[model samples]
Target: MLAVPYPYLIARMRGLKRGNHNYYKTLRNYTHIVAGSPFAEKVMRQAYELTGTRIYKNTALPFAWDLLQEERQQQIRREFTNYFPQSEGKKIAALLVFGDISKMKKTPFRNVNMQELADSIGKDWFFVTNSQELAEASYVLPAEYRERFGFVNRIMPTQNLLYIADSLVTNNCRFAGSYAIRRKPVHVLRYTGNVFEKYVQEDYNDMYIGQIDKEMVKIQSGQMRPDQQAFCKEMSYDNPKEPYGVIGEILTKPF
Candidate 1:
């Protein structure tokens, strides 16, 4: 697992912080965008700063946040070495999970379609449900090249699923883990949402931070086994639907 440096964009946003309430509010909104918080004046301001328009107010904030995350992923790839082997001489196939995206009603399987779109662009492509699906799907390929493509299980969370999906489209090998075994001309991108959100709080210097730090230390020292990392990846301050949350009533309209 190569560590990608946090984007300077984040640091630049954070640098705008001042001790004043207005400044803090601005910072909070900027963080909200990254955390997929609902729309607010502050969030709108941050979006304008980044995109020069208020397009996100009309679009879903999760999608907007995903775009930002994709940009960050690109930055990571640019700065880090290739982790997966080369795919120059072989064709590739991808298997993606249709998780919550399938439940969206409006954009179900949009990501899966995106994968097909990538394949149409040039790369040989196929889609399957699981490892067994891979085996069944393989028989459809030409006999000479039946072994050139591989299957990947799409049993991970959404966030990790996108990472693997991005890797497949870009032909980045660093994310092609053990699924590359058998030299079957295939690559695998397993979804791992176990560490989806960590460190999503407003105050990192508070007692909560100390407690989190202690838990992290325990995990690092092998004294504990956590199902997921101790971190908050999303912010809910602007979401009116969230319990005990408050964003301005004016911002809650379905405009």
Candidate 2:
């Protein structure tokens, strides 16, 4: 529906999200793709086979690191520690592998092999989800060798744990973008396997890990221009055009 009138809207910016039918349906019509993350770009490219000079002609711009402040993030992490054990030598890791409860078939949990991750990491692991009831269940574990997953009730507070922890392991869920935008590293799993690979994959695109680290290092070290943050906001060009571009191009170049 948005694709019908988005071009006429002044914003002219389109954001591709997870599990949304509209973005998938209108994939071919878009000329500029402002992906939530470069990982999304790979999914779209694999699913639709969009070429650089053809559809999505403009280079996709990443969404900014729009999240809570440092003090607030720390608060959430501290609260997380109350529920789980403390980290000794290695940093604790939080795993968020669940997605839309209404669509369980689409989640990576089905084939993720949780027991394997629990065995491999062999460290403090907190399994987070969007479900509240499950979170309560996680808290009351038998205090013995309980299930390998600890549960979190809220997404925001759970993500705050991400900031404090050393790493994150998620599927094609939106949280991957959280780590990406913040310049944090997240080890993505083979979420959803081939079921939705064309639409979403957890592979390492430069956006997810490599490039993000270097840029974040620059910001921390003050190697960036003083006005880099401000300049980034102004340089966000989404290749705007009249809504007619979708139709006009088809009519003009049917070949």
Candidate 3:
């Protein structure tokens, strides 16, 4: 079996200072480590120097992120007909909340209460996350709007959900890359939260640095950053094929 670790555990394996002891030691037992992204490969190489096929080997190709076909989009619409009807009055927002992190000092919300955000944005907003975010949000959400903005426990072809959304906000959220590639307007918040906030935090990063107020106004009108085109192009892969076929060829054929 192959070990395909994402950035989650890779960033945690560390030693005293110079090198990563955990990855180096553990890598000795595996035939190969399949890195999903260039960032993941960089993280792995930082943890341990790549020796050969036995230690580490990467195809260097990102996972297939082809554009969502029209049929698939239609199917998703049909599957979740209630959530999205005609897509006119949507004002949809996809908040990728991994962990609450509201308690953290530098968080976007900072000292603000979670429930406060409920009143800030209009209706038709929803969250896309597993159990962790769902549990974190249960307490802070205002009771009246709970059913208005529902939660998706899980969705097959997860990218479909992002396609339906007009805006995406995330904080160190793992799947933000997917959203960027889909050409959907993505906002990587300084911290993660289930409740989507329209308040633009300019000091958070250089992306929203100078024209933050203006950008906030634009975002309110459902316009994405003009600079995100390159990002979407670079990160997206239109190929429908999986890399597993290459893995099989490599194992069977001599080189």
TM-scores for all predictions: 0.25, 0.42, 0.53
Clash pairs of candidate 2? Answer: none
Cα lDDT, all candidates:
0.27, 0.39, 0.45
Q: Which digits, one per residue and each the tens of the lDDT, describe model 2 over residues 56-83?
A: 3223222123232477566766666566
Candidate 3 residue spans exceeding 4 A from truth: 1-5, 9-25, 28-34, 54-69, 86-91, 100-160, 192-218, 221-244, 247-255
Writing each residue's lDDT as its tens digit, candidate 1 over 1-255 gives 011112222332344343222223223222223222221333235423432222222112332233234565454333221321233332223344222333344432222323223333233322222335334545555643343344334333323333333222111222221111111222212222111111112322211111211221221221211211111111222221321122233256355
C-alpha displacement of 197 in model 1, angstroms?
A: 30
Clashes of 2: 0
Query: Model 1, residue 231: what's the lDDT?
Result: 12
Best candidate, TM-score: 3
Error of 3 at 174 (Å): 2.5
lDDT-based ranking: 3, 2, 1
Candidate 2 regions exceeding 4 Å error are: 1-68, 85-90, 98-116, 124-144, 147-149, 154-158, 190-255
Clashes of each: 9, 0, 0
Top candidate when judged by lDDT against the true structure: 3
In terms of lDDT, the poorest run of 10 residues in model 2 is 1-10
Listing every candidate in turn, what is its Cα RMSD in Å to the true structure after a full C-alpha superposition? 18.7, 12.6, 7.5
